[model samples]
Target: MYQLYYSPRNASAAVHWLLHDLNVPYELIRVDRKQQQQKSAEYLKLNPSGRIPTLLIDDQPLSETAAILITLCERHPEQAKMPALVSPDRSKFWQWMMYLTNTLQNELMVYFYPHTTDSNGIEAIKQAQVVRLAEILTLIDRELSHHTYLVGDTLTACDFFLFLLGYWCLALPQPLTEYPNLTRFMRLMAKHPSITAVNDIEQFDLDCDIFTFID
Candidate 1:
């Protein structure tokens, strides 16, 4: 069984959901972000970066959400959570995965933690980042209008990753629900057995569509 260290609604969420989607046996160890347990020396030993959702595969620690998702998919090819090694969609899979992680995910980090780099003008930084995020969202919304899935017609890890990021966007200025296609995507993904199971465990109110823009 894989061991996953996670905190509720953290970056670990995607990995947590994927583990269930893949129907793999796994153990969840809550890192208690509220109490700063992720930075604890004991936890740091397992993950030097002190991040959550570290998967213990063969008793080896693996970090990064995208890496974990790919590893799990590659390990359980029968589940078909990702593309075949030679499939044409393989490139598209990598493209969306990297865009989600390196581009969209990083933009969110800046929006949420602007003070990390611009303590003097945190709000200003966030205002600028929000514009960039909106552009990213619009691009994704347009893309979704044409493709049933993020990559090909079938469900893949990219969809799961997008769902995780969309969950974060629930608090954005322009609510995720405002994007018709993304809202459609999220609503559809929320009903998946794997997502539903994780929602119940995490106590997330995704089913109720708890998203509203506060002006």
Candidate 2:
């Protein structure tokens, strides 16, 4: 059995959704971020970064959403939640995954915590960052304009990655309605059975009130 250390409304939702999609037996161990439980020595031993969504598989621990998603896809190829390495679409598949994990996610973190790093010319830098994020969102909107999912027609890890990003964006005062395709994509993603399972998890409701954007 796999043990997943997670907080309800965080990026952990990605892994939670993936596990539900796989229907793989697993244990959900709640890590309360507000309580700073992730910083505990015992938890630190599992993930030095003290982040949520740490997966313990037979005592071996794994961290990071991209790595976890890839591992799950590989471990259970029968699930077909991700594209095959040799598949021609694999490059684009992995590109979108990394883009979400690295670029989109990093930018959003900056938006939320502008003081963490030197803002330099504070006002100017914030404006530039917002512009960059808007451009990225526009690109995603264009991509989804023609296809139902990030990769093509089917639900893949890429979709989950973007879905979580959209979820975060939705919580902000800024509405994603500006990006019509993205809004539609999120609505479509909300209907996935796997996603529904994640919402049904005990902690999801309390933690992900932002997801109510779908309703």
Candidate 3:
């Protein structure tokens, strides 16, 4: 069985969704963020970066959410979590995956940890980042309006990655519901059995939707 070191609502969330979606037998180990367990000596040995959602594949550590997702998909093409490696679809998948992580997810990191990026006027810097992220959201909302899925008609790991990022966007000033296409996408994804399985384990209050705005 695979093992994932995660903290609630951290970047590890995407990996958690992937494991559930594929029905892969795995262990979820919560490295408490509040307690600073992620930086503990043992965990640091596994992930030199001391980040959450490190996957142990046969006792080997794989850090970075994007890398782990792509590796899992490549290793288990039989699971159909991603496209065939040499196929054009795989090329498109890489495009979305890299864009999601490097572009979108990076924005979120700055938004979440502005202190690390800006030495002064953290709130001002954060608000600026939020404004920038809003533009990114609007762009994705527009693209999502035309495509049922991010890459293709069928769901892929890219969608799962974006879904978790959307989950993090619950704090946005405009609210994700304002973007009709994004709201629709999140609502539909929320109903998936795999997503619900992770929700149950994570203790998220499903009674209230993550992005708000009903139907």
Candidate 4:
């Protein structure tokens, strides 16, 4: 069995969705952000960075959502079947995942938590991140026009990763539904039973209208 430490509506959500998608028995250990439980000594012992979505596989612990998802996919090949070990799409899968995590998510965090990056120029940094976010969204929007999923037709952990990012994009002044291709892809993703289960567990009120806005 796997053990997952999650905080509602955090970066850990992607991992949570993946855990459900895998359909393997896993225990969710909630780290209450309100009480600073993630930073607690016990939690820090699991993750030195004191981050979230730490999965305990066997007796060992795994951190970083991207790495964890890749590991899980490799472990449970019967589930996703997309991130194949030996294929051209395998490389492309890594490409899109890294772009979402390292590029888009990196900028989004800076924007969402500006004080961590620039204490004095918070507003300037945040506004700059907004522009960067839009540009990244456009690239993803275009990619979706070519393929249904990030790498290929079948669903992969990358979809869950992108779903969490796109879901959070709701906080932006511009609605994600504006990106027709991306919204179309998102609508397809929103119907997945694994995602439905995760939202019910986390009580995430993801706006279903985002689905309704498109076809």
Candidate 5:
């Protein structure tokens, strides 16, 4: 069985959703970020970065959402609803996942807590970051216009990553009304039974506290 260490509302949720979709049995180990459980020495031994959503598969620990999702796809190729490692579409899948993780996720973090990095000039940085994030969202909105999922017809890890990013926007101080396609995609993702079932788990909440803007 896979052992997942994560905080609700973190990238861990994406892994949780994927596990549910694959019908894989796993143990959910909650790392209470509010209580600084992620920084505890015991957790650090598992993941020095102290990040949530670390998956322990057969005693091997894996971090990063993209990496974990790819690992899952590799382990359970038969249950793939997403692109497989050897598929021609794998490149596209990797592109979208990295974009969501590196670009969208990073910008959202900066937008939430500008002061965390720029102690003296937070407002200016926040404004600039927000504009850049809005531009990125606009591009994503256009991309979703012609495709139901990020890569192809069936839902993939790419779509789950994008969905998590879009969900963050919903709780942001800024509204997502400007991105119509993104809004539509978010609505569709919410209706998936796998996603709903993950939410039903006692530890998972639809309104995740970790993603809420921290400013």
Candidate 6:
């Protein structure tokens, strides 16, 4: 059985959702961020970066959400969560996955944790990120307007990654539902059994109409 060290609603949720989608046996070990448990020596040993998720497979630990996600998808190729090596969609998959993790997720981190930057310019940095993030969302929404999924019709781990990012946007001053194409994509993904399971376990109300504005 795989062992996953995670914190609810963290980047780990994407991996958790994939595990459920793959229907694989896995154990969840919560690293309580509230108590700084991720920085504990024991947890750090498994993940030197002291991140929320460190998946243990075959007695080896793996960190980094994107790497972990690709590993899982490759390991369970029968599920086809990652396209085949020679598949035409393969390149597109890599593109969006990197864009989601490197571009979008990083900006979101800055938006949420502005203190990570220069103390005197935290507000300015965060406001700049807001404008940049809006542009990123527009690109994603435009892409979704062309295809049912990020890469194409077939759902991949990239979609799950997108879902995670969209979920994070719930805390933004402007709701994610404002983007119609993104909202449709999110609504479809929100109904998936894997996503539903993860949401229930994490206690996130992402599968409902919570995004609808209260006029």
* TM, every model: 0.93, 0.88, 0.92, 0.94, 0.89, 0.94
- Can you write out model 6's per-residue Cα lDDT over 1-215, one digit (the tens) per residue? 99999888899999999999999999999889999999999998999888878999998999999999999999999999988999999999999999999999999998998775467798888789889999999999999999899999999999999988998887777878778889888888877898876675777686356544333
**Per-residue CA lDDT of candidate 3, range 1-215, in tens?**
99999887778878898888887799988888999888999999999898888999999999999999999887778988787767677888888899899989999988988775546788887899989999989988987888888877789999989988887887777678778888788877877787778785666544566435455
Candidate 2 is scored at a TM of 0.88
Off by over 4 Å in 4: 116-120
RMSD of 5: 4.6
lDDT of 5 by residue, 1-215 (tens): 99999777788888888888889999999888889999999999989998887999998899988889988988898987567667887888888888988999989988876765556788888789878988899989988888888786778877777877788776565687668778777777776777887775524345543323232
Candidate 3, poorest ten consecutive residues by summed lDDT: 204-213
lDDT of each: 0.85, 0.81, 0.84, 0.84, 0.80, 0.89
Candidate 6 residue runs with Cα over 4 Å from true position: 116-120, 207-215
Per-residue lDDT tens digits for candidate 4, residues 1-215, read 99989988787888888878778898988999999998999999999988887999996989988888888888998885456676779888999888888998888888888865556798888788888899999999989889898788878889989988888887887888778888888888888888777786666665667865644
lDDT of 1 at 31: 88
lDDT tens readout by residue for model 2, 119-196: 476665566778888988999899888888888877887788788889778655457888988887877777778887
Compared with the true structure, model 4 gives a TM-score of: 0.94
Which tens-of-lDDT digit does each residue in 1-215 have in candidate 1? 99999887888888888899888799998888889998999999999998777999989999999999999989999998888988999988989999999999999998997765546788888889989999999989988998788986799999989988988887778877668888888877877788788786666676454432222
Off by over 4 Å in 2: 116-126, 202-215
What's the lDDT for candidate 5? 0.80
**Ten contiguous residues minimizing lDDT sum, candidate 4:** 206-215
C-alpha RMSD values across all candidates: 2.9, 3.0, 1.9, 1.7, 4.6, 2.1
Clashing pairs in 3: none
